[model samples]
Target: MHVARHKWRSSKTAQRGVEELNAQVARHEGRVQIVNPEGLHPLATRPTLREYISQLWARRFFITADARAKALRTTRDYRLWQLWLVLNPLFDVALYGFLFGMLLKTSRGIENFIGFLFIGIIFMSMMTGLMNSGISLMQSSRSMIRAFQFPRASIPFSTTLRSMIDNVLPAIVALLAAFLFQWGTWPSWTLILVVPLFILIHIFGCGLMLITARLTAQIPEAKTILGLVSRGLFFLSGVMFSIDRFAEHSAVHQVMSANPCYIFLTAVRDASIYRTAPSLATWGELVAWSVGAFVLGFIFFWRAEDKYVRLV
Candidate 1:
């Protein structure tokens, strides 16, 4: 019994000594960081925001190549290839024109109804496409995310970049069509604003991609949630008809006006169709939405950077 007591006291003394040593070594915490000096074990922790941003920038080339490959893969399977970009929007115009313009007569008092519909459908495609791009990436990219030792944020960023590449031609076509049809101010300088608007939409899409990518990774059902949200935004954004259909003081008018999607579409329509300079208020709202979404989404995604592989 005396020998056992001596051993137990020795064990307690050794443990206290080890704890003191560890506390001394750990400057910020009362713990120990075990470094495998033999280089057999590599230790990595979630990077600081500054380090995360740096890592993302360093991998920009990889992201670009991935985006390029994705963009090419999408069209490679289709016989019409890139022509589908222009054709798809035209087809939507025809279909929606028949459904809403003729059947529902939603375009009754709206001037240049074709142009209005064209601008709404073509421009709003970015929002819907980015949404799908964001949500679907979580499932489709599981293999790449698991096999690679990369920043998972790269996946969504590349998806957003891919979207921007696919959108360029369609955007140019929309602008030209609206101008030629005299749907917007034909000789207006405000059309130049579409360039900035395009970039703004890209940034906003990146934000959405980051946000939804993380959400869908953590929760498989977020895809369905995002779909419902997309359909809701579609109706609220006034894509097929004017929000003026709602009374000025009604709930929809208030909500649509405040909605980021609606605000973005309104700004683009002004630049693309009306030939009028977007009001400062419009620019302000656009800037706020685009920048705010991107910054917040990136941070949100970054917070769970270490868990992506396991979550998906």
Candidate 2:
């Protein structure tokens, strides 16, 4: 009985020793706190809320934040001067409406010339801003490119976004006027697609701008050439006419349909003008363009990134 009791006590002591060693190991590894401020064991701490939010903002927030800051600052300037952002577009609308819709009576049987002008003008303004910002990005951001290491592509993106925000007032006014005048009753559901479509357009625009900015930054004449091209694109884009009006003529319709900008504009117009979803081909083309442009622009811009500072 004495030998049996000795063996049992030895086994128990061994088990306890093993467990104690494990606890010491864990403390040394910092898995468990060994010392506290009062010379006692401590508890683990977690990240603070501000640190968590800062980490979240650091990732993927640059694109939206930088763009938004630019927009807000620009708008504040105009607002401080008591000049509304929509004033210019509104003035242009009034002048054009009087000359084309009234003086020349060009609208003819069109019930709401003002609404028509607003839509067309807003579309043109958005496109122009997108294209111009993209083209001028490198030139305008020479110092920024030289000094900073953030994504160079984000500059034009932010510029386009800034312009898009600036035009929000015009978009709202345009839609409101159309609804009030009963120009073309666009279903709210159809208009919901505008957000994604605009995103695609913005992506493509940024990519195109990156390529053009690099090209123009190298060759000054590229600017004039691009301006001329933009002018031609405007006329060919069918800002003033509905695609349906040209449907009777196959050749003209086909030519117009082939132009990417025209197709995109028509897709938007279809939703707004006819209150219907666009064809599969329209969605496919926009996706294809977005993917293709982004890939090509990235490759092209990456190659030229090393040269930006030298040129600037």
Which candidate should be chosen as best, given TM-score against the real structure?
A: 1
**For this target, which candidate reaches the highest lDDT against the unseen true structure?**
1
lDDT of 2 by residue, 1-312 (tens): 999999999999999999999998777844554565676542322234454335434644676777777774555655453256656777877776777667866576554556666777676667666776656568788787777754555666567667667667767776676566764464668887766777777667767776777778788678888888877777666655454567799998888778777766766655664567887878999889877886687567656655666665
Residue-pair clash count for candidate 2:
0
RMSD of each: 10.5, 20.9
- Candidate 1 residue 174 C-alpha distance from true site, Å: 1.5
Q: Report the CA-based lDDT of candidate 1 relative to the real structure.
A: 0.83
> What clash pairs does model 2 have?
none
Badly placed stretches (over 4 Å) of model 2 are 1-59, 75-83, 99-113, 183-188, 243-252
Off by over 4 Å in 1: 1-44, 183-185
TM-score for each of the candidates: 0.83, 0.70
Clashing pairs in 1: 184-273
